[model samples]
Target chain A: MVFSRYNSSHSTAPSAPELPPESYHQPQQQQYQSYYGQPSSIYGQSGGFPAGTQPDVVRAFQMVDRDRSGFIDEHELQQALSSGYQRFNLRTIRLLMFLFKNPYDSLRIGPAEFASLWSCLGHWRAIFERFDRDRSGKIDSMELRDALYSLGYAVPPSVFQVLISKYDNGTGKAGLDFDSFVECGMIVKGLTDKFKEKDKEYRGSATLSYDSFLCMVIPFLVSYD
Target chain B: MVFSRYNSSHSTAPSAPELPPESYHQPQQQQYQSYYGQPSSIYGQSGGFPAGTQPDVVRAFQMVDRDRSGFIDEHELQQALSSGYQRFNLRTIRLLMFLFKNPYDSLRIGPAEFASLWSCLGHWRAIFERFDRDRSGKIDSMELRDALYSLGYAVPPSVFQVLISKYDNGTGKAGLDFDSFVECGMIVKGLTDKFKEKDKEYRGSATLSYDSFLCMVIPFLVSYD
Candidate 1:
C-alpha cells in the first residue's frame, strides 16, 4: 500500500497524459480475430508472444520509432506514449521493457522485441475488455478483484487496498486503465503461479525452507540478471 | 518438481531417522485447552507463543537438549526427532531455526525460542487436525491440497507433485506427519499473507512494481537481519 501511495502521488500531477482510450486500438484487429477466441494462444507454449502478430507489430513499432532509427530507447518510449496521451509510472515502463525481452542488454526496444510487446498488448486489451464489466473504459477495484479471482488468486482486502491505491489516479477513486490493469494482472499471475509451484498437491499450501522460499520468490521480485 | 526429486533422493537413505509421532506432543495441552478452542490466542498479540505454554515448552526443550547444554543444536534436534522416528530434511531444520527466532548468530534453540516454536506447533497441530479429515496421523497429497486451499492457496497439480515428493517418505506413499505438515503450512501462510498485503483491494490480485514486490517478499524468504 505504501508503494502504491508513493507511485500514485508521484505520477498523479495534472501532467498525467490525457490520451483518448481509442488511441490504443489493436493494430490489426481483423487479422487477429481468429486467434482472439483462443485467448491463450497470445502467450505461446513458452508464455511469450506469438510470432504471427509481427507485421502489424512492426507497423506499430515504426509509429513509435519517430526517429526511424529502427530502435526505441526508454526516453523515446515515454515520449511516444505521452504523445499518444498514455502516461505510465516508471515501474510500469521498466516492467514492459523486461517483458518485451530487451536484447543486447542495451535497454532499447528493436523490431523483434517491439513485435513481441505489441502482441502482448493486444492480448492484454482483450483481457481488459473481459473484466471491464461496466464498459466505463476503466476497471474499478471491485472489477479488478473479480478479474484476479478469475485468474486464481484470492487476495485479502487489506492487501487489495494497497494495490488499488497504488494505481488509483489522484482522483481518490480506485480505477485502472487498460495498461494498469494488464500490468497488475501480469504481476499477480506471475507471482501466483510461482507460489502454486510450491503448493504442489494443490493443497493450497506448501512448506518451503527459508532458502528455497528465497530462491523461488527472488526472481519474481527483482529482475537483476 | 526437480527440487523435490533432489530432496527425496538425497534423503532416501535407510539411515534417515524414523521418529515416532507421539514425540511431538502439544507442550501444554491442558493449560492451553482454553486457548486451543479459540485457536487465535496461540499467536498472542506480539505474534509469539502464549505465556501459558511456557512451562511445557521448557520441558520439551529440555527433552531435546539431551546433553543438558541449555540449548538444542541442529544435530540434537535432528537426533531427537529421529529418535522419535520423525526425520526431517535439512531445509526444514534450517527453517525451524529461523522460525524459532534463534537469539545468537549460532544455530541453536534455547528455552525462550523453543517456547515460541512450541506455541506455533500447537496451532499447527490444530490446523493439521482440521485438515486431516480421515483422522489419520499423516496427511496425503489430496488432504494436503484441501488444507492449503482452505488456507487460501489454489495450488496446481504439477506443483502439488513436487511438494508431495519432497516430503513423502520412501514407503511409496505420500504422507506427512505433524511436523512436516506444520512446516509446510507455516511457509504457505507466511507467503500468502505477504502477497495479500499487496493485494489489499481484496481484488484477488495486486500489481507490484519489481522493487516493491521484492521489499515485501524478501523478509518472508530470509532472516538475514
Candidate 2:
C-alpha cells in the first residue's frame, strides 16, 4: 500500500520519459552502470577506462563493444546490464572494477560468462537465448500478463485493466510493447524472464514440474527473498 | 544511490502541519486512534462490527484499527497504511464510506497475528520483542549498527544522524535499540539468516555457530561482493 503511495505520481502515460523509481531502481547512479538499459544520457562518458586493467576487465570491455565500435552504444550496454554481467549491487561492480581496473585486463563479459554468474546464483533467466518468442522484438500485454500470472500475482482481468491503464500508452492504445514493457519491469524483466525461460528449457517439456520450478527459482529467491 | 534521494525526502521531519490534514502531533493522533484501528470504525456511529464477514477482509479492517479507539484518526490510518494491511489505500478508505460498502467482517487484530505480518515485511525500525533484548522502549545504536555492518553497506553515519535527530527529538539523540537493529537485518540481511535463525531457534541454542554465521552473514556477501 505504501508502494502505491510512492507510485501514484508515476508517468501518466506509460510511454512517458520514465516511470517512478521504486526501491529497486536505486542502482542507476553507480559508476559501473555500464551495459544496462538504454543509457539515459548521463551514461557512456567514462572515457575509455585507463590502462593496466585486469585481463577480465580488458576482455569484458572489448567483447561488450560489439561491431568493433570503439565504445559500446546503448543497445550493447542495455543487453549487458539486463544480462548477469551485473546482477548484485554497486559494491560487486566496485569489487569487479577493483579486481580488473587495468584497461588491458578489462573483462568484457560474454553471454556465457554472464550466464554462469547468474546460474551460480540460481538465476536461470540469465540463460535466456533471447526473448520475443514470437520474434516481435518485444513482448506484448497478454504475453506479460500470462507470465506474471505464472509467477502468482493472481492478476485477474480487473488487475489487468488497472495494469494496462497504469502502463499502456501506445498512441491512445492500452498495453505495452517491448520498450514500454521493459521499462515497467525497470529493465529487470530481462532478468526475470531469463529464469522463466530457463525453467522452461530445463524441464525440456513445455510444462514445469513443481520440483523443477523450486529447483530453478528457489536459490535466487532464497538468496534475495 | 537512489536510496539517498528517497531518504532525503521521506526522512525529513514531518513538515509543520500547515494544512488541516497533516496538522497534528503524533500523541494527539494516538489517543484518538487507539480505539479505531479495527473493523469497528465502519460502525463508528453505531459502535460495533456487524457479525458475518469474510475473514481476510475482517482481518484487514481490524489491523487498520491499530488502536482500539472507537474512531480511527487520520494518523492512526497512516500507521496502518505503512503496515501490511492493504485497506489503508487512500481510495479504499474513501470508497468504503461513500459506497456504503462494508466488505469486511470483524476488525480486531490480536497482537500475535500482527506480529507475524510485521515479521514478513517491515521497515527499518520497530520490530517488537525479537531483538529488543533488554525490552527497553527504544533501539540502541550499537546493536543495530553491528547488525547492518554484517549485511554490507556501511550504514552511512548520516542516515543515523538524521533518524536520531528526528525520532529522538526529545532525547536529542536517535540510535537503534536492539529491536530496530534486528528489524534492519531481517529486511536487508537476506534469507540465509531465515534458515539460520530457524535452525537456531529450532535447536534452542543460546550461542550461534559459524555455520549459522556463514548462512546468516556470508551469503549476504553475494549481494555486496
Candidate 3:
C-alpha cells in the first residue's frame, strides 16, 4: 500500500539527463562573470581595484604629507624637509611663493602651473656630500653646525635650536640631524636623481678636496674667538 | 724678460726667486697669495703670504653683502641665489622673514647664524634633485615648474616670469632652469656641501616615484601650488 501510494506522485516526475563529472564543479560556470575584490589594486580590472599599472602615487603622497592635512604646504614642506628630505631646494621656493601668495587664506596651487615648473636640483648632491661628515646618509644637528661653520659661518645654539624645533617631530629632540632633515626635504620637494657623476674637475683636483675645504672653511666661519 | 724691461731697477736686481718646475705647481698656494698677498715667494725668501690656512669668514660675509650694507638681506640674498647656489630651503625665507621682523635697521644674520642656517637648509637636496632633471647641476623656470608640478603644485607663468625677473642676470631667459635656480637658492641660503654616497636615491624614476609623489602633495601648502 505504501509503495502503491508513493507511485502516484513518483511516476509523474520527469527524469533529467545526468551531468558529467566535471559538470559537478562547473555548475556555476555561467555565473562566473568577472574578476573583482582586492585591496590597493589598480584600474582596468573587473574588480574595484585598479587593473593597469597605476602609479603608487597615492601612497607616495601620503608619505610626503607629514602633517596629514590631506595636502602638502610650505610649513608641512619645511617640516618634511626637516624630518629627512634634504633635497627640497629653496630655488623651487621662488616658484612655490609665486604659485600662490598670502599663506593664511589661500592654499590651492594649480596643476597646470605646477606641470610647468623646474625639473631637478642636482647641485645639492654635491652640497650634501660636503656636510654629511660621517657619511652616515644623514646630517645630525652637530654635523649641521659643523658643516655650517665649515662654510665660513657660525650659528648660535638658540637660533639653531629654534630652526630645528620648527621641524621637530615632537620627539622632544633638540635639533635636526642630517638624515632626518634631508628626508623631510625629499618629501617636500618630490625629488628624483636623474644622473650620477662626480665633478671630474673638482674630484680630480682643485683648490682643495671638498673634505679639505670643509676642514678649512668650518674653522674660518666660526665666530668664536 | 723682455716685457719686464720697463721695471729696469727691480728686474735687473734679480731678487725674485726662480719659479718652481713645471711638474709641481701650487696654484691654490699661489692664488692664496693673490687674494691675501704673500709676504714670501721662495724657499730662501720668506716674504710669501702667511701660510695661514684659516679662511677669512668676515670677508666671505662682506663679499656676500655686495652693497657694503654691513648685513645681507633678502635682496642681497636673491642676488646671490640668481648667481648660482640652491642649498637654502624654507629656512632662507624664515631667515629673511626674521630679518624683516627686526626693528633695527642694523639687523644682520651673523656668520655663526649663517653657518647653522645653511646647515639647516643643506637638507633641501631632495628639492634640488627633482628640479635638476637633466642632472646638469641646476634648474631653470621650466624645470622648476616641473618640479613644483611633481609636488602637486604649479606656478603660473606670470608669477614665474616676475620671480625670475627679480634676479634676471640680463640673460633675458624669462625663467630659470635647475642650475640657475639652485645657484639662486644657494645665494639665498648663502652658498654652502660635500660627503655622502652621491645621492643616487634622489635620481630619476619617472613613474610616480618619490618626486612625483611630492609633486602630488605640494598643491595645498603654506605657499606652493
Clashes found in each candidate (C-alpha, N, C closer than 3 A): 28, 43, 120
Ranking by TM-score: 1, 2, 3
Give per-model TM-scores: 0.34, 0.25, 0.20
lDDT of 1 by residue, A1-225 (tens): 322222122323212111112222233232234444665453343222234554444444556666544457665665545543356555466556644534333356555455545555555566568888778989888888876654444555665655564455324467777667756755554454455455444443454543354345533332111
Q: List model 1 lDDT by residue over B1-225, tens digit each.
A: 322211122323211111112223234323334453564443344223334554545455556765554457766666544543356655466566644544342356654456555555555566578878778888887888776655444445555554554454323356777767756755554555455455444443455543354345533332211
| Candidate 3 residue lDDT tens string, B70-145 | 3455555544443334434443444343422222222344333333333333333566576666786656656665
Question: For model 3, how does the per-residue alpha-carbon lDDT over A76-174 read when each residue is reduced to its tens digit?
Answer: 433333333344544334334332222221232211112122112222334556777567666656665554443322334553444344344324343
Residue lDDT tens for model 2, A54-115: 34544554566655434442344444454434333332332322222223222233322333
For model 2 the local lDDT of residue A112 reads: 25
Query: Against the true structure, what is every candidate's RMSD?
Result: 17.8, 18.3, 25.2
Q: What number of backbone clashes does candidate 2 have, counting pairs of residues 3 or more apart or in separate chains?
A: 43
Q: Residue-wise lDDT of candidate 2 within B75-179, one digit each (tens)?
A: 344365354433343322222121121112112222222333333323333333444577774555555554344333234455443333323423554555333
After TM-score superposition, the amount by which residue A89's alpha carbon in candidate 1 deviates from its true location, in angstroms, is 2.8
Candidate 2's displacement at residue A67, Å, is 26
